[model samples]
Target chain A: TTPLTFREAPEYLTDEKKTPFDAVAKYNNFYEFGTGKGDPAKYAHEMSVDPWSVEVDGECARPGRYALEDLLKPHDYEERIYRLRCVEAWSMVIPWVGVPLATVLSRLEPNSRAKYVYFETLHDPKQMRGQRSLFSTIDWPYREGLRMDEAMNELSFLAIGLYGETLPNQNGAPIRLVVPWKYGFKSIKSIVRIRFLEEQPKTTWELLAPSEYGFYANVNPEVDHPRWSQKRERRLPSGVLRPNWMETRMFNGYKEQVAHLYKGMDLAKFY
Target chain B: MAKVIVFCVALMPLIWLVTDVVLGRIGPDPGQEITERLGIAAFQLLLVTLLITPLKKMTGWPGWLRHRRMLGLFAFFYAVLHVLAFLQLILGWGDLWATFTRRPYIALGAVAFLLMIPLALTSTKAMMKRMGRRWKPVHRLIYLSAIFAWLHFLWQARSDVTEMVVYGLLLLALLFIRAYWFGVSSLVPLRKSRA
Candidate 1:
């Protein structure tokens, strides 16, 4: 399918009324560029993101390397205005355009043993200045994973674009994962690989600091990160003296769609 | 001579902050940006202060000792700005209980600021002389304050921890250098006795 044929469904546009793109772009937590919210917008421009390829491997029947163009060409894009909550106490409403991850994974045809999906980013230190720093705790070629069920969830999107434009390099171009219900980091950026595995796959943040960053990394306000409280978040681009900056909702307000995924399990423990 | 230059250098950020505010370039929330900048500056100055003794021991830079006080006071100055910014911008001096109780990051930041008050107040020649034998022990709280300040920064950064981690590593390196110096010196005395 050509890019012109890609259109957002009416349901997605209705959601956009409640959550705007300005809030989404202004209130972001993209650390790859720098720690500041504005850093992504400024420094992400330095990234050489074209000529990207995503390698699909592990237990999949048709595991092979696919160029970004080929991967994004087949799907009809839809806008999803998701409330993105960071593990830190902050949030934003993002209008992301992409195909459902379930739709993409179904085409890949996972083998019976496939229990989890792993993702990795490009490892070029020259292009990614963050990778050059030895002081950074995050390992180079940042990685993240999700259980097979989580990967197949309708809420999860293999996002290709945002705000009616192609994904900015700072916002994880050419493609990124978007698990709207989970904390922002669970939505890994600049993905170059997808692996289906039998065992629970190791994620980069969890591997770096397991005690601090749990494996699930789901958006459960009750499960406070060891260092800080997750109960509340500061909305970005806050006016000089505006009180009542938007309040954070449970599961980043995707509870209606995804709360059932973790039913019967204790959220505090999984968190 | 170097001490004076170091003191002036440390005040550059504060000067830039005032200029930014005056130029209308401080964005809509000048107060929050100022508070964050000042808090970060205080932590950076504290990290520099913590490095003085280690640098003196390692490189025999006796001049480093003279600059330590100035750097420490700069840390206190920026900390004052940080607290004032929070009060004026975030708290607004109304609803005292709500201001103090609602946000835990504010509390963590306040504790760090409170701890520094004693250190800053006692940083005078008169106070140091009056305290005499107790001065060294009291000044040791600077180390604790630095750790608290680091924790405050870490806690404030919810999702994007890159800045906090950068500052955290700098503090760690400074602390590590001190521990290494102490370990080496203690080992030297034992070696000399054996010899």
Candidate 2:
């Protein structure tokens, strides 16, 4: 494989304080590996990303299985530093290396029938120890979706690497989606398939609880998850004495860029 | 000597946590890590404290009776740290009153800790003497606190409740053993475990 040519990150899109790469890899909610914060780092090494192929199907005009390298071959890779707020009220500003989802969507040539893009993660319990655990309520082969406009947004990213290095197994290598405006869970990890759908797709968290986790799952300070408040987020690399919270912003502070996509729609209802 | 060993064992989680922070190790979200560690330590200690009475009842372990108060107090100590970890690390020591009012789980957790305060104070020989016959009734608040602590844990378990169910089952077994002792077999007017 060719070494990735790193692009200079745009100033406006990145965070100045880079969370240590070790922190990014160690703390995760990837249930395929495990549910604990450290579980993915411990067990995700079993994940096989090299031989990966993504199935792009459904309403797209060009639908077929594309090897990971061939699918991403034509696109330019850019690093984005964006805030990732978990529904659990924790957040991180990650420097992700990948191109916009729009670039991939355009290449696939989605027909007028495509209203949503549904993503699926790897489901093999033999490799993913967490998938084998009957303890998890979430149905396996994690799924997520984005509206057509949201998928095409400038802020929507599909991350392949981090901190100028190929992604670690725990951080969703060799490729994953990174939607900055939505909660981290919406950016599905270790994605294996992408399907264009006419109706809103059933996502993992929403299936677990429709009231608590909606399909949109956008980061909104005002819209409290029925379980807890999303008004404040504890930034990673928290200082020992003073672990202060940063006020969570609507659409994770990408409001100007992506808020128009939800025009005239009740965000709280869609939340 | 065994009490001192138990004290050190009780203190280990906090020691591990402090050292991890000093070594810059407690992972990416230290706040969440510390918060959960302390909360779990407190919850586990509460479970162990509750277990003492049953062990004494079942195995007739004299040592279980001797160390019950210390174990209960240590449980109280961890509860304090658990409460402070939330207020300090997560809340940044801001508006605790708001925390009690706004977040019901925090309030549940707070109530559990509040229940511990009087129990700790009364566990002392002087206070036990001061309260006399009323002391036993007051310390029974442990049962209520344990329920609150478990609920506090279960409420935050948004996605999975496997651990919560385990903890809940443990508490239920403990309570069932007590109820069985008083109501069924041991009607022979046994002496109180705590002298």
Candidate 3:
């Protein structure tokens, strides 16, 4: 098998300069390793991520587990630098390398009954200490879901790697979902399952706090969480003194591709 | 000797926290770091405060009580710095009214800070005497402030809850010891001995 060469494709460029992946990888919101920004980068090395497989089932015509190698072998990897915004008011631009999610889901062959696509992360408590924590409000086997249309969006990527390397465990090593336009949690990490469902599937954060985290966690500056403001987000590698933070943009600046998806509905209510 | 060493060691994190903030290493949101440092300082002070009774009871260390006021005041000192950092960095005076009115988390933090004011003001012996019996009740609010402080930390956290859990356990242990002491004193009678 030939070694796959992934390349970076800039989505949003400001004055002809692409956003750096260092900015994206360094400033992350992965809590499984720890709470701090740097904690994930430090502690995620402990994760054992090889020999991975993803199980596909539910409303799909063919239901079976596929090896990570076999699943990734077909696609030509392209690095698309995307603006990632967290619900907690922070943003980063990541250069992600993967095929479009639609391209991957098309191979699964979803039936007419498939209305939603649910994702699940690996549930090994031995490797993931966060799973063992009793105080965590989130249930084990962190799960996320998307509407079938949302899953098939061109903007969504079935990301296998990031920052010009194979995925780091902290950033969901081996493979993960990257929905750039949505809030950070919507992009589930270390995915092991992709099940097509007839109904709207429950998500991890939404299950933890429904009012705070919605199923459609699109980047809407107008919709604020009960605890904090969404109007601004600290762009990471946060410098000292004034102007460290940036004004948050709607749909994480992917309004061209995604804003139409939420046209008729009220975002504030859904948020 | 061990107690003094432990007390000094606990102060190390506080020292580091301050030095890091001054050196501009705590990132853009120094307020969050300040809050975390103060919370840890407060917890350590509370632990030290609880240790006073145990040391005095078990080892006949009467001098332990002398350190209580200092430890309690240090806790308040860090807490005040935490509140000021939040005001200066996060809530900025221009947005203070909006934050106080709109954001629930800010209100929770503000209430916690407000509760600490009376405790800090009456910490001196002169005010303690002037306030008389009210001092005890006023100081009791520290327990409530600890709860608020924990909640403030818990709510501020994005996803990882491990740090909050550790703090919660420490607070629980200290509260448990106090409850056990009270329960034993109230329920059990002392035996009379003839010389």
Candidate 4:
């Protein structure tokens, strides 16, 4: 695999004012750096992202540590303007430059028993001080899982860059997952390992607060978060004093594409 | 001069928030930033208001009591700002029913604000004179209001409650001191006489 390049996005997707690169780069939930909004920008400099490798194993035909560059060589890339909605009720319209995760997963060649795709983030406490800090509430080496079909969705992207620049450290440097329909946390960051599983992997958030955050965190305005309303989201790159809040769409308005996957499942229960 | 200084000090955060908004210094989500800052300012001012009584008792300074009304009003001021921002910016003053049903933390914030209304309206010397001995009992609502304020903050946190725990401890200590000073200790004048 070799590094892929991104060009112009489709015309229909370019409507929202692109989130200023600085804001996207600066404001993030990469808790690996620290808990505060600006902490990542302040502490991410210490995170070395170059010369990284992702380990692929479990239920796969070819399992080994693959260099970040070689992993991307075979796939075609595109820049898609996506509305990145955070579980915290804030959202940003990002122009993400990357290849589809489906493209990569297919290349890995999952065996007959590969029912689920499990992902894990880097666990180094030295680079990520939050891992070592006693105040952290989340379990480190954060893990997430998606059914094989969900991972193969057309919308499931493996992001490498944003605003045409290589993925910034705070925005999950080198590589990260981008699942537009699901809440942001479902898309894990700074992934170090990926495995094929027959059963669902216990995600970090689900273990921490099961009732609050479900495994399938599909964005639904009707099913409000216990603490805050998801009915409306502050679409970012908004005015400083007054943000224009728009009614949140079910599946963040990606219903036509991804809704078929969860046809009969109780959304409220899954949420 | 101290009155003006205290007033300015309390209002400085609001001023900075407005100035930052104009300059585009706040990040992508300005609504969230403004809302959180207003809420925090309200909480901080309310906490400071509680500090006055203890500080006065420890230092034997009656002057602190004069600024107590202004300080409490500042807390209420921020509370009002916080709610207004939530309504105008976050909720768009739309679907009030939906907001009430879906999000309970907003209710805690609203209840805290409503509790402060009477205290603010009665802050004037005229109302204090009008209420006479009843005024003291009415103003005791601040303790409950402060508790609501803290709960509102604490409930919104998903996890990592280190800061909220600190505030909770501070509020508990203040309430404990008040209960001893005014509740049981006031009636026990015998102890003061013996000392």
Model 2, runs deviating above 4 Å: A1-3, A9-15, B95-98, B130-133, B184-195
lDDT of the candidates, in the order given: 0.73, 0.83, 0.73, 0.84
Write the number of the candidate with greater DockQ, choosing between 1 and 2. Answer: 2
Tens-digit lDDT track for model 1 on A87-193? 75555567777888888887788999999988987777667666665556676677889989889987889887787677877778778999978888899988899
Q: Which stretches of candidate 3 lie over 4 Å from their true place?
A: A1-4, A10-27, A34-38, B1-11, B18-31, B101-103, B129-134, B154-166, B176-195
What is candidate 1's TM-score against the reference?
Answer: 0.75
Q: Which residue pairs collide in model 2, if any?
A: none
What candidate 3 keeps of the native contacts, as a fraction, is 0.25
Question: Backbone clashes per model, in order?
Answer: 2, 0, 1, 3
Fnat of all models, as shown: 0.16, 0.64, 0.25, 0.64
Interface RMSD, model 1, angstroms: 5.3
Worst 10 contiguous positions by lDDT, candidate 2 chain A: A1-10
Give each prediction's DockQ, rounded to 2 decimals: 0.19, 0.57, 0.30, 0.50
Highest TM-score, which number? 2
Candidate 1: tens digits of C-alpha lDDT, residues B150-171: 7777765534566677787887
Tens digit of lDDT per residue, candidate 3, span A1-271? 1134775555532332334555455545666765576667777766788788999999988789998886775446887777778887766666677888898898889999999999999887777766666666667688999989989988989887776677767788778999988999999998999999999988988888887899999888888777777888766545433434677888888888987778898888877
Which stretches of model 1 miss by more than 4 angstroms? A1-5, A14-39, A241-244, B1-11, B18-35, B46-72, B83-112, B123-195
For each candidate, give the interface RMSD after superposing the true interface residues on Cα: 5.3, 1.9, 3.3, 2.1
* Pairs of residues at least 3 apart in sequence or in different chains that clash in candidate 3: A9-A79
Best by lDDT: 4
